[model samples]
Target chain A: MKKTELLFLKEDVDIPYNWAAGRYGSLFLTRLRDEGKFIGNRCPSCGKVYLPPRVVCGPCFTPPEEIVELGDTGTLVSYSVVNYPFIDPETGSRRPIPYTLGYIRLDGCDTYLSHFVDETDPAKLTPGLRVKAVFRPREERTGRLQDVLHFKIVD
Target chain B: MATKVAVVGIGMTENKSRWDLSLPGLYRLAYQRALEDCGLKSEDIDAVAFGHSPEYFEGVNHPEKWCGEAVGALNKPLFRVHTGGTVGGSVAIAAYYLVASGKFEVVLAISGNKLNETSSAQIGLSTVYDPIMGRQFAAGAPSAVAVQASKYYSQYGYNEDHGLMVAVKNRNNALKNPYAQLRIPDYTLEGARNTPMLCHPLRLADMCPTSDAACAMIFAAEHRVEAITDNPAWVLSAVAVNEGINYVDRDWSKPIGLRKAAELAYERAGIKDPRRELDVVEVYDAFSVQELIWYEGLKLCDWGEGGRLMESGATRMEGDIPVNPSGGTLCANSIGASAMFRKAEAALQVMGRAGEHQIPGVRRALGHGWGGGIQFHTIMIFGKDKP
Candidate 1:
């Protein structure tokens, strides 16, 4: 007799981390949530403004002192559209398929931000295309990079 | 000593994130710079020594495996040393031993820490504490140093202002140091005083900024020194000591290990007095108060008289003896290279190669590095004339 299906037990992993985002992380997250705008940290040594502000510049090994405000519009560097189905770790459910993921360089940053894009079409989702971040409503905003819902293609 | 050794070449990369270069590339730059400094070929080096801060900071253990070739260790014996912040100093001592033991005629020592690979070095530093007790409160280095600062202030009858003065002085000095990282123009005690306190008795201004930096020094036997450079910074003596921590009778201010290291270094260097004989000095001041405390540990001043020594302008750039003329760990602290910079700066001063921050007429100079719960201490003395 042939087996119809495989048997398995499914449960959520109960690991909880009281993660400290550190000084730079805390500053970036709080500002993203409160102002609904991106702030950049500039490495004083090599003059690069990193995305997801960090304490030291990876290239120069120097601490960045300058805080720069960034525009919402950016250029999509490279991207891939999801066609395969996978479980969403956040919600414990199958994530919607055919979602576009892009690495975008914001107007004033030297580093790229990896996030979702609204455009799903491979043709429409062109490299070097201008994109703008779409943020969650003020009341619903959480202090996270997810505060910005996704990037929408711009003309 | 079986064979006399002298530092023939020194190379230092600017302390910063160094985002532009790979870890191997950074090591290569410093090694190449050192080779160029003394006109040495890769074939001239017989051995290489590598040192770096704990692997947790960069999330890469045994960086020496790949970095060894970058420092000209290919087909040569490589010695790797790691002693927390004093890794650089220890590497220098290791190279000295390699050459002095008659085993190697020419040796190159390299040390650095790329702290940016990890999100926060504090998270890596947090793991350095005693897991059973200290890990629970894991504020990392700052919390421990703050307590030390409080103890020093309480014992010496000094206040936060003393540290503020050191901060201002070092930052101002950094303006003259082309390689220094935190060159705050027109830095003043008043400005530093107003900066918000991160921990008690510790202002944000009083702390060392972390950088991804590397330092390289080439040591050669006396016979090989003339071919490398005309004026070699002769190593007079090098000493490393460690202090045991005690919960019952702990006193961070006294610094027993540093005192013992200094005493041994001075004795072996045949120096009667450090203040008068040493023309320049570099001490690992990871934090501002540590500089003052190190003054006592180095015997530049009596215990509790470090604040007074600073007040007397003895360590100022234009004082009786210049301390941290290169802006020191205060301005550019690359954890692995931080302590090594102390030795390299002193060597540069005595060699008359220290550019903008060069002190006039430096005959003898001293470098000091301390780390690992303030337990380990390394002291190196260099002289213009061979001992």
Candidate 2:
């Protein structure tokens, strides 16, 4: 096989996007920002509390009614300690290496919340371990899930 | 009764991170091979169904416009399916629907992905999630699947060795497949275990490579297939099932979407026992652990026995029901062509044209694809004889 010369070019392109929080999402975030509380909507048919408050129940196909308050503590369902460093898409910067990611089933909610774990060591994390959400100070609250910095091991 | 459809031709390109071929060149290479395999002209194809993942992977928007002429579907009814990673199987399903509806006699399904073209494939995939809820947290496919692997590991009594066993077997199988991208000719459990971990419990070797390749298959009505080929792989059934996008309602380990899809397909194909009745299988295994999860999801084994199923060596090429003899998605995953590769490989197995990977006397086979946060699942059944 003959060696082939290759030419390459690199260019940057920008694609802008604007998204609507929707009625349910906006309500959930507003409550978290103002009152520093987590709110979920209860399905009318199945009565499953959907965290982040989706408008309708996917299985039942019925709209949820009444946003209810949820607890900050939960059980760890699954977790991973990422060992590689990669550029974060949201910030376009390198995220801290060896971070612990987890799925937590918050109390009073049926679904698992995908989030980061405060502990970076894999040995400390275990399935069914009780954890509590640590929120940012009230003045610095952004209303996003990030306001609840990460889940930490709780007694 | 509905019209029946069968696969009369299949073609594929070498799975690689091709820096030489243009996007259109890849499509043309696979498309021409399919036409030659069935002894038909491009003009014979009445319509085309193109499958692809996100356009950002190749930095191209509306790719059909740039590549339609290469596939010889310039002015025909060219439909595009973009169901995330499951697009490949959905494209095949779309082609089957076109012919089975009796509206089209011949249809062509084509798909491929060139991950090398992207600046960062992992970051590109992260954009698929909600910008507000998930985009910031999602690290890519490996981390996402890691959580699922953790859940499965916690629910079951399996360990990392089970995942390593899967990696060793799939890569060994790829050695027999000429078109496969990753072929560790001298693969072993030790090498797989020693590979660097990408995420906890998931190593570099456990994940699929980002490949650049094209796959094309020709689908025809039963009546039309009679004149085209004597050994047609009849498409007995096809089904796609989708669950809610929310991760809350999902049990990633169980993959209810895939079970639902398999149930519908097996019911339609009259398959009472998948392990007993089906001769071969090609389920999605982008991650090594996923193959085991699929065994349970597809009902090949009882729940929580996926790891034991691997340890039993029942899924090997020479086992009772050979799975992924063509090496599966884990060996050569062109995101867009990955699912269709399963379908094409299954057809080849039933048609006795798989060459080295051919399972002897394959009477019935199943091809499956799962994508979109373990939510979208597609399954198709193929048989040697018409249903």
With candidate 1 superimposed using the best TM-score fit, by how many Å does residue A4's alpha carbon deviate from the native? 54
What digit string (tens of lDDT, one per residue) describes model 2 on residues B12-103? 99999887888898989999999999999999999999988889898889998889999898679999898878888999999999999999
How well does candidate 2 score on lDDT at residue B53?
A: 87
On a 0 to 100 scale, what is the lDDT of residue B352 in model 2? 92
Residue pairs in candidate 2 whose N, alpha carbon or C atoms collide under 3 angstroms: none
User: Clashes per prediction?
Assistant: 15, 0
Clashes of 1: 15
The candidates' DockQ values read: 0.01, 0.67
The segments of candidate 2 whose C-alpha lies over 4 angstroms from its true place after superposition are: A1-6, B247-249
True contacts kept of 1: 0.00
